[model samples]
Target: MADRITLTGLRVFGRHGVFEHEKRDGQEFIVDITAFLDLTPAATSDDLTKTLHYGELAELAAGIVAGEPYDLIESVAGKIADEVFAKDARLTEIEVTVHKPSAPIPLTFDDVAVTVHRVR
Candidate 1:
């Protein structure tokens, strides 16, 4: 199996939703990205440089989400997928989950989340 690194529960505040208020006021969003890449070198070398830095990636993602205000979560998820690929070319595949904890819905619910997978 290849090396797998997962960044979980990365929280960010962004304007992403179908509602008008959601786009204007924004909401809390959670991002979870699972990356699959080669780990043989990092395993043997035990060097930080040899492995993917998820912290950096998460920060970059946050910046992007904060910068790019998309109307829908789907666009946000797609941007994240594109951003991850731009950050690390070695990432063979990535699974991205975007969660809207404060969705403006009439019914009571915990949150609304969307997950997407992209292969490079």
Candidate 2:
């Protein structure tokens, strides 16, 4: 679908990394979600029920990011996509991006992120 709902820069704390300290200390993760679906029904009717509730979407993503401990940001991205797809049947597709800014690396970098795209 051409119509889409996008939620960006969702920050949540997560204990996800390869190292032990990462799991123990935890860190912040930023998530971005784009859900593609037909918006004609909601737009014409002006009904909230006909469209995806972004607040609920944000909560869903936040819970996922804060709930699970993963070894990779890629896994986090995938999980977010899976959960979003499961939560909304109206969605034709979804793209999820998980950002890990405090990743343990020797080199200097602005950010590290992984994106996962899923089609229903």
Candidate 3:
């Protein structure tokens, strides 16, 4: 699809890490989702029903990020993509990015993230 809807900087708290401390003390996770679909229908009709409701999409992704504890953010990204695809059939493709800013790395880094792309 040529048209897309994107949501960025969605922050959620979750206990998702390999270390025990990480599981015990949850951290924040940032998520970004890009949903690709034909926007012609919605644009032409000027109706919300013809397009994906971004608020609902954000809620769906936020639930996943806050609900599960995964060893990897890669898994988190994949789960978001899977759930997003399941929630909306109109989307032709989706890109999910999970950011771990407070990752337990020994070295100083600005951020750690994983991105996944899925096509329907």
Evaluate model 1: give its lDDT.
Answer: 0.83
lDDT of 3 by residue, 6-63 (tens): 9999999999999999989999999999999999999999999999999999999999
Q: How high is the CA lDDT of each candidate model?
A: 0.83, 0.94, 0.94
Rate residue 88 of model 3 by lDDT: 85
> What's the best-to-worst order under TM-score?
2, 3, 1
Off by over 4 Å in 2: none
Clashing pairs in 1: none
Per-prediction tally of clashes: 0, 0, 0
lDDT at residue 68 of model 3 (Cα atoms): 71
Q: For candidate 2, lDDT tens digit of each residue in 1-120? A: 799999999999999999999999999999999999999999999999999999999999999899979999898899889988888899999999999999999899999999899987
lDDT of 1 by residue, 1-120 (tens): 357999889988888767777778887899888888998889999998888887888987798677767777888888888888887888899888888888777899998888888987
- Please give the TM-score that candidate 2 achieves against the real structure: 0.97
Q: Candidate 2, 96: how far from true, in Å?
A: 0.1
lDDT agreement of model 2 with the native: 0.94
